[model samples]
Target chain A: MHIEVVANIGEARSDDLLHKTVIVVDVLRATSTIITALANGCKAIVPVETVMKAKEQVQEGDLLGGERYCKKIPGFDFGNSPLEYTREAVQGKRIILTTTNGTRGIQKSMKADHILAGALLNGRACAQAAIALKKDTVILCAGTQDVFSFEDGICAGLILEELTYTLGEKNVLINDFGLAMRGSYLHSKDRLFETLVSCANGKKMSRSGFHDDLILCAKSNIMDQVPIWEHDQMILLPRSLARSTF
Target chain B: MHIEVVANIGEARSDDLLHKTVIVVDVLRATSTIITALANGCKAIVPVETVMKAKEQVQEGDLLGGERYCKKIPGFDFGNSPLEYTREAVQGKRIILTTTNGTRGIQKSMKADHILAGALLNGRACAQAAIALKKDTVILCAGTQDVFSFEDGICAGLILEELTYTLGEKNVLINDFGLAMRGSYLHSKDRLFETLVSCANGKKMSRSGFHDDLILCAKSNIMDQVPIWEHDQMILLPRSLARSTF
Candidate 1:
């Protein structure tokens, strides 16, 4: 199987992603937030690319949660921080989410056969979940603004590493992007925390005194959830319910 | 000083390249051919993205050259091989060229204050030329058909390494794309020939019986030519003439 990774969602074509497994990553911290909300028993996440789109999705049972420039949007229930996704607040509620990059990446991949949200927080599980699908994969990084972001690229590399290492025997193939991300992951693996803190998004968070968000984003393989896209929203299936279609 | 490396030209906006120095690389053939043609004393080369556009630029003194897929077009003077650009035929002649990706990259950066072609052949000279200008630089890799091309990324990385190392005292800053290329270059530097032969483009050229072109492309830093974009064409100025504009 061939794996392609687009550093930006702008490079993705709907036709190419059609019927293929697409994984969207925004490490600090859209995907992290989605997986956290789902793992904590949130009903579903409706990922919209823009704040206006999120506002349009408001309902009595839906919580508006996301960020614009790393700040919680006015009237939103939560920002992009995973720490804000505690069970007490989000349990059994639908979430309408919008962020600078990650949601855009997801909306771009709406044609994907199986769309999943991934991050450094749930990297190993996310990789394994994609591999189990047995379909060609496209890993899209949701960069900050329209430009490439540091933490996201490294997170993409981590997933690529898992996919390549675990499924090497299957003779999986990767293009330049996949190879590039693998190299990025290898280069930054030893100093992931330091690397994240030095990137633009991290500096933005740190400058705004969001040290806890950085620490949470740095923790790897701690969350075993994979937010699978279905019916216009993302919901994590319990491990027992994750076999065919979540 | 700041250096931004767009993984491919598709990600670059014209406004972003406006009044900035742009360096474009297509290591597989287009830029390599341009560098080779200029190094061999060709008067000027016009790089066009499409075959029909190259046909439109035909003139009494200009020779048309380029490729469709790794092979020469039906009625072109020569295919996009550095070997075909030898002094005996192309010396003192203008070459109007079209290729799959590299020319598109050049045309996209037409609004730049200073634009130049770069490749593995003249990597160091190209990087040094950009560094001497002391302007913020954008290294655009002419990836294959809007996708990440392996050799181009490595060539970009080599340029980044040179720029960072030479201007160490100036505190050169690189973003995620820059760091990714640097890592990619370091990963493939030791085995450039092997690396080139294994990439998708390399394999296509090899399968089509262009082993010689692959070897030429794999050889780095042999040519000292820098084809600076001037007046809608690329021409190389001698070392004495290169200080300000080449």
Candidate 2:
């Protein structure tokens, strides 16, 4: 399979993502939060681009969860932190989420046949989901405000490494950016948490009192759940569905 | 020191580059070729954005050197390969050089206080020169046709690593992309030639019968000379001048 790793949402062309599996990665921490919320039994995540749209998407039982400039939106249920997305707070609930970069990335990739939320937390499962879908993939790194972020690139590297491992090196063709990300991931695999802490977003998040979130988002493949976009909402792919494809 | 590593020439902003030392890198093989030609005692290199501009820039006794689509331009004295620029051929001759990416990078960086050509072959020297210039630095990777290339990223990584080594890790503040490039470089430093051979540009160059260029461009710090833009031409920075700043 061929994989194209884009640097950020701004660089991803909607035309290029058509008929391909686009894995939207925002390691710190939009996708990470979505994965955590879904894994904690949230029914689905309605990711919108604007704050007003996020509020409009919400129904009676839906919760508003997102952040702007790393702070929780005023009067929202939660911020963009995986740690805030707990089992008790999010169970069986539909969440209307909007953030600076990640949701925009999801919206930008609306042209893809399949869009999966990927992060270091569920990289392997995401890779498996992509393989099962049987399409060439585009790993779009949701960088901070259109600037390339190290955390997202590292997560892209993780997903690429996982894909390479499952498909064998000869069968997987990666773009130059993907190759660089893979090398970056391999070099920092042993110290992911530390590596994230040193990156631009990580440092900002840490200064904003999101240290726990960083630690949580930096863990690789800790959760088996992979969040796949369906019916305009992100829902966890059933384990049986992924396994049966193999 | 603050360092910003841009992914390609298209991403480099002229406003941000002002008052900074910009290191333009095109490891496979524009910057590498310029460094080779300069080190072979070439008088200077005039980098132009177009073939017509290159032709117009050449004066009496000046040799035209460059490539279009990796092949020597019609009736030009040389191609982009560093091997073709031997001492016997380039010594004391002024070279009007233009290539697909590297020259474009240099032209884009013209707004900077200082512009230096960098590659894996002169990464250390470029870092040293930037330090001596005493300005915030920007390493611009002249990727292939506005897309990121692994070779130039690796060269940026090498320069970042060298900067960190000389300035100490805490003293050097690098952008997120620079950090990723540093990690990628460290991961592949032990087998740079093999790493380059496997990259997108490397494979293309090799297939086009420029395997020797890839091998030569992949070697790190083989030359101590750094090419600096001075009075509209790229000339070797005198060692005395670099040392005097210290």
Candidate 3:
């Protein structure tokens, strides 16, 4: 199957994603945070476009997790940093999350037949799940602040590289942005951590005193669960769950 | 100066380009066509967003040049191939152009203080003109059919590479998309011609019998002229004219 990449959230529309397997990458923290929440036993994650919508969606017991411009909203239970998603904090609870860029991508991609939350943390699982879905795919990179961001592009390339490695014999066509991203990833895969740390978003996060979050995002495939989207909610799916899933 | 790359026309609005210098790349043909028209002694080029507007703008001597889907539109004098713009045909004539994607990008970028039509044909010249203007720049890639195209991204990266080589110490910050593009260019620059012929757009053009257009587009620095936008029209700027252009 062919793979098309929407380089930023701006290029994606709900209609275009319909009937396709869409993998959303926001590597700086949003998807990473989701994976962390899932691995730590969070029940389910609901991603909304804005903080107000996030607040409205949260139930009495469900925690609100999100950030606006990288700062935690005044009353939210957590910011977007993955390091803050401790088992004691999120375990066995549901979370309604929003972030500056990533949530916007998820909100726009809700129409996809299958939506996968992908990050460097659970990249392998995400890749395999996408391949297992066996449909035309779209990799949507949620750029920082409505503009292109390097960290997300690197993660997108990593995913494409993974897919190419496992499914090389398949007929796949990566659009230009996808090709460029894969090229960037191949060039920096050896120094993935340092490269992410030096990219524009990485520097912004570091300067904003979020070095730990950067470290957490740079760790490759540390988590094995793939966060799969069904009916607008994302929950980590094991191979068994995804295989049985449509 | 910061380098922001709007990967496709969909991501751009004229207001965002206001007071900034915008470099537009449509390597598969539109910008390449503009560069060829200017290089062949065309007096001026007016880029319009629609076929109806192009028809209205064309006078008896003013040629209509553009494409709809890699084929020449009915009644248009040209089909966006650089080879069609021979000195004998385009010399001293004015051309009104409209294409599916490139013209849209130009219309969206009109508010910029400086708008340049750039492509692989005159990549070095376009990059030099951007530096000479000394303004915050955005590389607007006119993607194929409102989606990312590899040839345009490669051309954008080539211009960025040219700028980096000549102005190595300048205060430059390339956005993530720009970095990824530059990386792709470095990887494929050695195989420039072969790579272009093998790219998605190139294959489409070749299959449609536009292989000659691809060859014309692959040559670098064929002409030293840069097409600079001013007063709602594009004029080929010589070094002497540009030096005094304010």
The candidate that achieves the highest DockQ relative to the unseen native structure = 2
Model 3 residue B241 distance off true place after TM-score fit, in angstroms: 5.7
Off by over 4 Å in 2: A244-246, B244-246
The weakest ten consecutive residues by lDDT in model 2 chain B span B237-246
- Candidate lDDT scores, in order, read 0.83, 0.91, 0.82
Report the lDDT tens digits of candidate 3 across residue range B137-165.
89999987667778888888888888888
Instruction: Supply DockQ values for each candidate.
Output: 0.43, 0.92, 0.49
Worst-scoring 10-residue span by lDDT in model 1 chain A: A237-246
- Report the TM-score of chain B alone for all candidates: 0.94, 0.96, 0.92
State TM-scores per candidate. 0.86, 0.97, 0.85
Cα deviation of B135, candidate 2, in Å: 0.3
TM-score, cand. 3: 0.85
The candidate scoring highest on TM-score is 2
What 10-residue stretch in candidate 2 chain A is worst by lDDT? A237-246
Give the CAPRI class of candidate 1: acceptable
Error of 1 at B94 (Å): 4.0
